[model samples]
Target chain A: MDEINLQRQSSTNDELVLIEEFFAQLTKPKNLDSIRDKAREFCQRNSHLKIALVTSGGTTIPIELNTVRFVDNFSAGTRGSASTEYLLKTEQYAVIFLFRHKSLEPFWRHFSSDELFSHLDVNPETNQVTVCPSFQPKLKEVISEQKKSENRLLKITFTTLSEYLFTLRELTMVLNELGSKAMLYLAAAVSDFYIPPENLAIHKIQSSEPLRLHFELVPKVLRPLVKFWVPDAFVISFKLETDENILLLKARNALKRYGHKLVIANELNTRKHKVTLVTEIDSESIQINSQNDEIEIEQLIVANVVERHNQFIHDQSSR
Target chain B: MDEINLQRQSSTNDELVLIEEFFAQLTKPKNLDSIRDKAREFCQRNSHLKIALVTSGGTTIPIELNTVRFVDNFSAGTRGSASTEYLLKTEQYAVIFLFRHKSLEPFWRHFSSDELFSHLDVNPETNQVTVCPSFQPKLKEVISEQKKSENRLLKITFTTLSEYLFTLRELTMVLNELGSKAMLYLAAAVSDFYIPPENLAIHKIQSSEPLRLHFELVPKVLRPLVKFWVPDAFVISFKLETDENILLLKARNALKRYGHKLVIANELNTRKHKVTLVTEIDSESIQINSQNDEIEIEQLIVANVVERHNQFIHDQSSR
Candidate 1:
């Protein structure tokens, strides 16, 4: 047991070194300071309201320094965006939405180019544009809700994996001031491997030759996030898998390693309809009534998470 | 010279086998039949108008069969969309725009989400939504142009490399009936390499180990496109390079290899402001006069291309 402990310590030390090198080589995002300021102001302004740092969409790993090519994780930000809308509806939480640029946004996801254009009417003589009568009610509701949540919602966009990590760290540190009232709902599909800056090509990779690539594991930031950054916050991380057999086991392992409050375990194909919430003590599955139902699974997921977060806050205060 | 000829013949034979295998493994795009029918109907209806197939945006290469991860090329469809609008302005051309899903569209590119919403006003009393007066003129112009070109323009969308290629072939064959009047404007930033379906992982690739990937060169579809599919069509291919020194040489090489009508060569950094048009006998560079010029380079590029196309038709008729 002692030998095993020593080996684990050595592995952790190596990881620390890797993380340090990773950050050292990364160029800080250009809008880091402004985003940090926005997040700080949001947290301070909503001191009474519970703050949720809801990360959405997928992060990209560039194969070239000039970034003509990149490896991307597949996510439309559906879960994160839908969950944000639900959380805002509860009136108890202020959200910092750190999302991928051009991915779906909360209320905006309902309108596609065709849907928006099809419902618009143009009065050529008056030089006016109006939403058709049938679409006005839905548009008005979305617009009003958007206005109500304007002050409570802070949006910060990131494109690359490095940018995402840098912003996530900065925001997490800022939210630490909130103590037990903060929640980290990490739903972004971050790339697990990346070609580091030094190894990336300076220009476009030519098509003249067959391509070979080697990528190193992206340093696991969740460890430092949970253990050091904001241990008092109610942390929730997501586990998405293609195979059902390993989904719960992976979620349980993540909980053991990170010591986070909950793991939202989901299979890729059925994720939109069902999810399993795995806490330290037990796991519970949540599913929509029917596949054809109009309800989003995020509606149920956010409610359950909110209840658990409330319990965590209450437990802390009692202790 | 004999030895070189033998080697070239062998290489060509190998490439043919690879192309055959590639298509054999690819699944046909689901909407291929509908898109083909649309293209055919447009061609038959507008037989007198010249047809231009303008491909835009970038194709993605899936790393796994389930496609949780992908390698993507960087393209915004700016050049293609802008060029299409300019082509339509000529009034003598009809465009079949084959584009990446969710990339910029011809007239719709002018307005972003924030731009669109900021100009919108909600009226709760009458249950109405209207565009603000200040933004009315621009909206009117875009909407009018969109309506005018509704019959002349056909839009088709693809996301993955296989889908792009399959649809491209099907569309090219359908456009073949138009003969020399058909102009192929190939501008899409297609991936140079891809992981074959047989070699791709069936599930999500585990993150426990460092990733090593080998990608085969995507077969040169341009050869078969020019030589077999649409030999009589006036084809214009684009060559993009980061290195200025190799740009023209590569463009010339492509013309010689594919026997296409023209090659539009552009350096990666200066593409927005300048491009060189390369034909069999000579090359000409076109550039916007000033950095702050409101005119898009695509306008100039399309005008020059149309002039050459006109001369080609005249020469053909004379022959």
Candidate 2:
């Protein structure tokens, strides 16, 4: 309960109070290097499928060599990662995730009740068992921790768009050889434009010079990709924006352009938002609205997405 | 280059054709199990760090819940595992990536471009190579991966909202001990509504009933999370949708609701989209339109985010 948790958290500052001091300490030598070997080891061990297919972290453009690849994306990996979870629900599908900085925290155990169990709490009014018996070391805790799926799927992270693209192109071939069941979901903040070839290394490296990275056109993945990779498998794409009123219109065009089974269209202002599912089956957009806490919108979508996929599988089986 | 790559692209349906026939043999093992092991190993090796900040693939919610959390989000990392590319960019962060089935193709080779280069070809019809020659032989490839000053930080990836919540809660304590110097970006598709505890999982797994999962609020990372982990380091959140023509109106509400820096807002339905930024300074909203692609949008937001963080760091140094 927030009531019990509040006792410990009451003193923690909610506002950005130490932005300067905290950030400065990070630059210190002691801060530059930290132990991530455990996390990396985790990625390497549980990955049932070794292949990785990333959409990077931004929107991608179709049909242009004079295009740019996103160095970064607004996509911190909410939807794509969630779907990745569903995809990982079974070993039949192996996943590779490359995410942005802000997006990596969830994977590290920051907000689970398990984490709360470890927090230290001391009753100031009276030394009391403010913590419940369940709080003490118990089998339930150990089982929860062990039955803990020990999520072992290779999850990689990325910040720039080029890295994602270059990685994907090759991944296509690998998955192609692996099976006819390969899939691709164009999620993330991929860019339609990339910094010119000449400037890629320098500009990306320098991190200076007015910072006017051009919005160049990126190659279209729909058709050529279909012709090239696992043509028989499924491929999904995305179209995002800040506007909520015109999702249908954008989805129609995106479906036509990408030919992906599901085109997810949504407004991009709050992390809590809604989505319009654009699929070819009926061309009717299914709007799903959500909030930040992720109780309502997420469950509906999760159950539906799983059911939808299950239906697709079921229909295939019957056929 | 695309034109040349296009020309060099062999019109060979050989691979696809081979896969099409093999499709019927679902039992035909493609040595994927070994690859899966390799992938898992990758995670295990990288799984070391006090605070691992990772994001899945969706948006976050915008409200509060039980005075604790709220509902929200849409991105499911059908493509998150490919986040390996981010690690390559800079060794500054530690990462563990678990991906979705649909996203494996995009980030397959990011961890090792040599594998990608092996798949390249020079179309007989055109002298140009379909894959970049500098990245040839896959064997000769050198990882030019950058570790943006933060790569050494440990990281992890989750597929479902539940998994994300579980892992997030676990990571919170580690970060708390280490200090609130990191950042969290709730950018995964965390389902807003969930199936109430017991029945929800059953309904979904057993395929019973119309799959009615009620809204049992997930924990809130955007608000209460800051109270524990990375409170001082910068945090960035996102909003995605197909509507919201008046960028300022949408962005203003986002800032007021979710306390994050640089909210990137855009129109999800338009081919030519625009992103409005919502930050501490431009709280009202500053739309950055783009007929090009998301890179333009990414650059705009990235620049501002970098600047803000840099400023925070600089201020700390001065102090």
DockQ of each: 0.72, 0.01
Candidate 2 lDDT, tens digit per residue, A125-172? 643212333433442333233223335344555444444544454455
Clashes of each: 0, 214
TM-score of chain B of 2: 0.54
Q: Pick the candidate with the highest DockQ.
A: 1
TM-score of each: 0.95, 0.36
Chain A TM-score of prediction number 2 = 0.59
Best by lDDT: 1
In candidate 2 chain A, what residue range of length 10 has the lowest lDDT sum? A202-211
Candidate 1, residue B15: how far the Cα is off, in Å: 6.6
lDDT for model 2: 0.42
Candidate 1 stretches greater than 4 Å from native: A1-18, B1-18
